[model samples]
Target: MVKKTIHEINARIRDGSVNVVTAEEMVNIVGELGPEGASREVDVVTTGTFGAMCSSGVWFNFGHSEPPIKMQKVWMNDVEAYTGVAAVDAYMGATQLSESQGMDYGGAHVIEDLLRGKSVDVHAISHGTDCYPRKVLDTSLSLDDMNQAIMINPRNAYQKYNAATNSSKQTIHTYMGSLLPRLGNVTYSGAGVLSPLSNDPEYLTIGTGTRIFLGGAQGYIVGQGTQHASAGMFGTLMVQGDLKKMSPDYIRAANFTGYGTSLYVGMGIPIPVLDERIAQATAVRDADITTSILDYSVPSRDRPVLRKVTYEELRSGHVELEGREVATSSLSSFKRARAIASELRDWISRGDFFVSMPVERLPGNTSSHAMKETEGVSFVSDIMSVSVVTIEKDASVYKAAKIIMETAFNHLPVVSKDNVLVGIVTAWDISKAVSQNKFDLVEDIMTRKVITARGDEQVAVVARRLDQHGVSALPVVNGGNHVVGIITSDDISKLFARRH
Candidate 1:
């Protein structure tokens, strides 16, 4: 059989004869007609998502004033904008916090206010020059006064993202929204099948230069987005568009309490059913896209995974966790997602828009690495004090207390005559021993089941162990279980402080 071409599809679209379907409709059609038959009938599938994207920002060019000052610094409604471009150009990052209002209002709010046609205070400063002598200017400007306004975002529309739940006793304020303590609520962010990249799993058609529906306006993919995970699965794209064509309804400013500002961007993509494989890919459902529920309480690159769940289960309003059904809420608006899909479908059916071929395919094997500390890794032996103030197990408590006071050490490791670590004594132990008039022996008041660290253990690992065990110090021991050094919280701080 001859394969259908994009030109043929465009011809049908131009003649008002093309069959376009929303992502939801395409799923049912593929189920009924199968991939081959659906590929022959369906010309396009429209997908969409409306979710918080913090990497979004807008660039503006203010018209020159009477005394055209080369703007060295610029601020819109007290939120700073990047003035590195030229005299009149500035870029406002969505997450840039408001200097006066803090996280409550930010650059994202400025963008939203501009889209709302509201006036904003514009403040600029410059070093005086002969041609442009104005040192400072403060005035109000609206979007209508700007020469060019464009939204250029580095990362948006993740294909799949993990749901978040707090396992710790305290609530966490994160970009995922507020995570309630002890899994009080679960929050997920993507629009599942309706998400653009989720439908186009492989960047087969959606790639650099491909036109998209961005904030209800025409936009194009620029490049691979930041944190664009490995292919054959999660994918992301950097997108840009003219803000003039966008509406405030499709793009809103959001302040994630403790996390800062982000843009709630509504975007859509039209997938051309060029072949059966493409048709099959677009037929993915909520149940097919899988992601895990992660505990954000753990402060580590590798957080603990609670459970893996399909989007279908998440969309069902509740998911089982720890033998109980937990309510789930989505940060992305499904209603708006459906509306974007429907609108994009109408645009395609009316021949107002045509799908463009990608200029180049995105890399399929790229993965992000965890950011390591610039100071580099330090082991227990590197930070541990070799001249450890040791207390003999048979030593009197009075002697131990005197040594601790003189050295100002909070903890002392009690050892045998052979220097084998037998126990650990803290200042609190000496205090209690002295209070009760029982200062006979150090071993009587010392903790026998003492935790120790190996000389080669990573400092971070040992530090975490200390935190978990509620201990301020760990005796560094060699292979023969002999105390070689001592590591305390203070020593760890000093090590990090020196490196930093």
Candidate 2:
């Protein structure tokens, strides 16, 4: 049960004696040899993910022109690049859509073309300076011609993500992919066992400054990503690498019809077999990770949760929802993920790649808050029906039954002579009164206990009271118990429907 140092593993890799395996393989190894024996035998466990990463881009230092012009604006292959840096530096974001081709092409395509050794048209305009007299420049540039080309992503490799489905009557076009209406299909976006953060679980050995294989090139974790929920059920990281060493096959441009453009990133991480804990972490399986199935049609931050499912069920290609089996599709490429893991393992075995300790640890207790609406909360007064039909306490049971049938309402507020809410009379009450031959006043048959809501109260609070009381509606009352309006389940549904 000896803990091996990273240096000793690197030495073994140099001598071609290191035992390297993919994260998927580590599961069986740990089960066969147990954590201690597996940790001693295994040098590194490689993990990978190949998915659409929109927060990806490459910054290039295109060498200064003969009559240098500070690039105030830039476009490569019709895709705009941010030229706000220096005179010759520019950043091309993956999701920046092509101006001419719309969603069909973008800056991600420019990166892929550049990596493929193909030239791209570069156009720039600048406010001419004394040292740089050129006002504009139109030219074609290749990767080899750039002074420096580096891929720096603010976010990539999400640890875990929910599978999405549409529970409503309309299809939903989202970043998760198209969710067919009424749970026609489910879409998930993770490599399960091959996902880097899934294998690492806790930040453990993988964190800021850790070396990794980024888009076919060696890279380092820069920091916590935009939504790096470490205390989250899943984990994530931001990464950077030299684009000069990457290949076109590992990085490609993607246009998702209505969803604009993004980069198909190929990434891999090597987990050092330092201890039994490390080995056990690397052996995490798809069945162990769970994610919720969200109804994307809700169109709110608090989207409805349909169900919770494991990655193993997600990978099975279908999941059951609403008593029907719905087909599932993956937004991530498992084949490419396996290939990247295998390639990373080869690099570590040949001493071409080495793991590094994190420069900084990710915060473990950070939590996310939902975005609040700018407008004030809606109250029951706004949505309640003002023209409420009521039955007087002195009204006959036959009269109350007639009013309920004509309005198609299940219940009616029973009011006193001065228009104050006395009780509630339902259609069932009148029917029971008639069956008992007690065709007297409505108050005699009505339920004396009435659930009432104040008009100034929040709609959510009123809705909760209706649910708690197991009632379909609540009589909205002003000061002194005067019935002003009526709030019903239908009203709440309509309110949320409009908001969504």
Evaluated at residue 283, the lDDT of candidate 1 is: 93
lDDT of 2 by residue, 212-329 (tens): 9999989999988887777765566789998989977789888785678889999999988888988998988999989999988764567789999998999998999989899999
List the RMSD of every prediction in angstroms. Answer: 6.1, 11.1
Expressed as tens digits, the lDDT of each residue in 1-500 for candidate 1 is: 32778789889989999999998999999999999999988989999999998889999999888788899999999999999888889999999999999999999999999999999999999997998899999999999999999999999988888899998666778899999989999999999988888787778889899999999999999988999985536678899999988988899999897789988999999999889888999999999999999988765567789999999999999999999999999998999999999999999999999988788987777887778767678888887888888989999999999998899678899999998899999999999999999979998999998888888778998888789789888988898878888899988888878867
Best by lDDT: 1
Quote each prediction's TM-score.
0.79, 0.75
Estimate candidate 2's alpha-carbon lDDT, on a 0 to 1 scale: 0.88
Indicate the TM-score of model 2. Answer: 0.75
